[model samples]
Target chain A: MQRTPFYQKHLDAGAKMVDFAGWEMPIHYGSQLQEHKQVRSDAGMFDVSHMVVLDLQGAEAKPYLLKLLANNVDKLKESGKALYSCMLNEQGGVIDDLIVYYLSDTAYRIVVNAGTREKDLAWMRQQLQGFDATLTERSDLAMLAVQGPNARAKVFSLMPADEIAIAELLKPFYGAQIGSWFIARTGYTGEDGFEMMFPAEQAEKVWDALVGAGIPPIGLGARDTLRLEAGMNLYGTDMDETTSALTSGLGWTIAWEPANRDFIGRQALEAEKAVGVQQKFVGLVLEGKGVLRSHMKVTCEAGEGEITSGTFSPSLGLAIALARVPVACGEQCSIEIRGKLYPAKVVKPVFVRQGQSVLS
Target chain B: MSNVPANLKYADSHEWILDQGDGTVTIGITDHAQALLGDLVFVELPEVGAQLTAGDECGVVESVKAASDIYAPVSGEVIEINHALEDSPELVNSDPYAAGWIFKLKLDSTAELTGLLTANAYSELVAAEA
Candidate 1:
């Protein structure tokens, strides 16, 4: 199995290693629950080097991305600005959801999910036949995500004086190049932090620096719960090649304006929208006992649905899930677990933000 | 290595049983099983006086990560259950061998206990699995 640069560090910290997407990644240092609570209350860093980083460079980069992404890259007028988009197939099926950072007209950086790296690269390369755009996979880079309420301050403590100044000026969803590092104020855990990327060889030093600053290392187990509590979707569990962005709680990522953007999935998405989207992606909070889990059957007054991702929410102290239900589903629904149905409440997909519950 | 108490009989599925020498015995998941399941958030136990067959699923232990079925180590009637777990299931993770005991069972026959693995044998089983 492939191991990241911090694999040894993880072992030293008493991490429980598991096979994840062909990589030997840490599932948790010791206790997943306590690590999750630590991130929610303080700061924690994640070794996210397994994610693929691809740099797009060429004169046609702008035009290429406009046709490539469901979300328009034209909105990213400023350098270092990042836009989240779903790369879709001709049938509106989600190929992958990614964050693309616009550095210049001829240069942009795209980060894709680790599990879909090969497929995404192949698809993107196939689509670049006519365009001048060149895609370069930065396998030489290692990435770390420092997240939580105090994550920024903790990370900034470890930065150089000049880099700290540049990092401090970054706004949400923005990135900046400081020395050899690309630091972005973007995260998956619905917390304030920086996702920093540097040379793979420098990973141990960077990790040690963060540790010296009192940022505990977190594993993927807590990462899943943190993202789930924040109501974010997991790629494989929540949506995949068979599901469309319209039905994956990602409609906002699609830019329907410009009237004629002609993106890869435009025609299919427009057709589906014209017919009135059949399913709605929503959040569910169990009203009573039992933990809701993926693939569980769900029923409401409108129709039946299935949970894509579900877990016991560490923040909310209850079971929460993301599900795709019939568009006409109401506020209340029931989830079937182990042959028994349990009641749940339908709420906005966002359960928490900035370390606090936003559910009402 | 996980804690495998020297006096208890173990099931391959990771349940542990402490024979009280009377007809009644106390049972719970092994420490290795609890570690594999992570933090327990909820637990479902068999009703008191419910009959169980060896190897049949009698309850469930739900953790934050996933749910695991609790199999009956030996056939018996559940005489009592640890009700404290209903509100705080984490007792399973914190004290799986003691206070986290899921239920007490009255054995149908003493012959069944001999079929279980001894502590030394169960340790080898855990090591092999690991």
Candidate 2:
């Protein structure tokens, strides 16, 4: 299994290591519950070095991205602006969901999932036939996400004086270069924080500084629960290459306006939209005993569906899930667990945001 | 180091059986088992008066990581179950030996006791696995 630059730090901190997408990653420092609560309550840091970062440079970079991603890249007018989009196949199926940063007129940075790196790269390369953009995967950089309510404050405390001003001025979904690092005011946990990418060799030094600043080191186990609570869709579990963004609660990422923008998968999405989407992604809260689990059956008056991702929310102290159900499904359904059906309340996919419950 | 009380009898599957000395015994998962499973989010216990045999899957413990079956160490009928686990499964992580006990089984025969390992033997087993 591959190990990140901070592997030794994780080992020294007594992390429970597990194999995640071929990487020997920390599942938890000790107690996953404690780590999750720490992120929700105060501040926590995650070593996300396994995620691949690719830099696209050339005069045609903007046009290349426009044809490649489902979301319109033209919306990124300001430098350092980030756009969350899905690279789709001709069938409108999501190849991968990613965040692209508009660094400059001819350069952009894209962060893709670790597991889908090779496939995503191959797809991007295949689509680069007519485009003049060059894609370079930056394996030399390590990524860290500092999250939760006090995450920014704790990170600022450790930043150099000159970088602090730039970091403080960064708006949501925007990034800026600070010193030798690129810090983005974006996160997966629906919390206020920055995802910083820097030279891999400096990972330990930065990690130690964050730890000294009282930012607890969290692992992938809590990271999953935190993102789930925030209603963020995991790449594989929530949606994969066979799933479309329309049915995966990501329709908002699709740009349908300016009808003349002939992006890949536009025809299929338009066709699907015309035919009407049959399945809708919805959030579920278990009203009865039992924890919701992925692949579990969900039944309602309209039809049956399956849970895409499920977990016990640490903040809500209840089992919650994201399920793809028939569009006619009502606000109440039942989830099958261990051969028994338990009632569940259907709600919007987002359960929490900004460290507070958004569910009614 | 995982805690293994010297007085309790252990099963190879990591369940602990405490003989109450009244033909009834309390059963629960070991600290090692709970630790491996991470935080327990839910637990399903067998109903009272349910007949169970040795090695039979009598209950389930679901943690955030995965779900595992809790087997009956020795065959008997369940006399009582820890209903409190329905709302607070973390008790298994907090106190696996005492308050987290899953059920009280009325043993069919005391002769089954000899099949279980002593605390020292169980400690060796856990150490070997680690």
Candidate 3:
């Protein structure tokens, strides 16, 4: 398995390493529950260097992105602005969900999920045939997400004198290139923090500095729970090549306006919408005993469905999940677990955000 | 390394059985098993009056990572279960050998205890898997 630049740091911290997307990454240092609570309550850092970072440049970069992503890139009017979008196939199936940062008119930074790196690159390269844009994977960089309610303040305390001011002024969903570092006020966990992308060689030093500053290192196990609690869709678990963005609780990310802008999956998505979507993705909270798990059958008034991603929410101290049920399944459903059906309440996909429960 | 108390008997499936001297015995998963499961959030225990055969699936331990079935190591009648796990499942991770014991069973036959592996044999079993 491949190792990230911070592999030694993870080992030194007593992390239990596991194979994730062909990379040997930390699952947890010791207690996954503690690491999860730390991120929700305080600051925690994650080694996210395994994610693929590509720099797209040349004059046609903007236009290329416009046609490449389902969401319109034209909305990113200012440099440093970021947009969450899904790269879909011709049939409206999501290829991968990604974040694209507008750096300049001719340059943009795109980060895609690690597991889909190879295919995403291949797809993007194939589409670059006539366009002048050049997509270069930045293997020379490392990414770290420092997240929590106090994440931003803690990260700023470690910034060098010259970059500290710029880092402080960065707005949410914006990134700034300061010296050799690209610090973005964004994160997978629903908290205020920076996704620091910097030179790969400086990874260990950066990790040490953060540790010295008392930011606990978090692992992928907590990362999953954090995102799930925030109602974020995990690329492979929540949606894949066979699933459409419309059915993945990501319909809002699609830019339906300016109907003339024909993106890759526009025709198929419009057709699916015209026919009336059969399945709708929503959040589920188990009202009874036992933890909800993936692939569990969900029966509702409309029909039966299956859970995409499910786990015990440490924040709410209950089992919560993301499921795709028949569109007409109202607010009540029963989930089958171990041959028994348990009642569950269907709610908006978001169960928690900003360290607080948003459920009604 | 996992704790394998010399006095407690073990099952190949990772359940540790402690003979309470009386007709009943207490059982729970081993330390290694709990570690492998990570932090447990919920546990489904068998009812007190339920009768279970050897190797029967009687309960489940659900951690954040995955859910694992708890099997009956020996034929027995369930006499008691740890109710604390329903609200605080982490007790299994924190004290697997003591307060974390899952259920008490009235052994169908004391001969079943001799069929279980000794602490030394259980240690070897875990080491081999590692």
- lDDT values of the candidates? 0.93, 0.94, 0.94
| Candidate 1 stretches greater than 4 Å from native | none
Q: B1-130 in candidate 3: lDDT tens per residue? A: 7888999999999999999888788999999999999999999999999999989999999999899999999999999999999888899999999989999999999999999999999999999999
Per-prediction TM-score of chain B? 0.98, 0.99, 0.98
- How many steric overlaps does candidate 3 have? 0
Reproduced native contacts, each prediction:
0.81, 0.76, 0.81
What clash count goes with each model? 0, 0, 0
- The CAPRI classification for model 1 reads as high
Q: Interface Cα RMSD per model, in Å?
A: 0.9, 0.9, 0.9
By lDDT, the better pick of 1 and 3 is 3
State which candidate, 2 or 3, has the greater DockQ.
3
Q: After TM-score superposition, what is the CA distance of residue A148 in candidate 1 from its true location, in Å? A: 0.7
Q: RMSD of candidate 2 to the true fold? A: 1.1
User: Which rank order by DockQ, best down to worst?
Assistant: 3, 1, 2
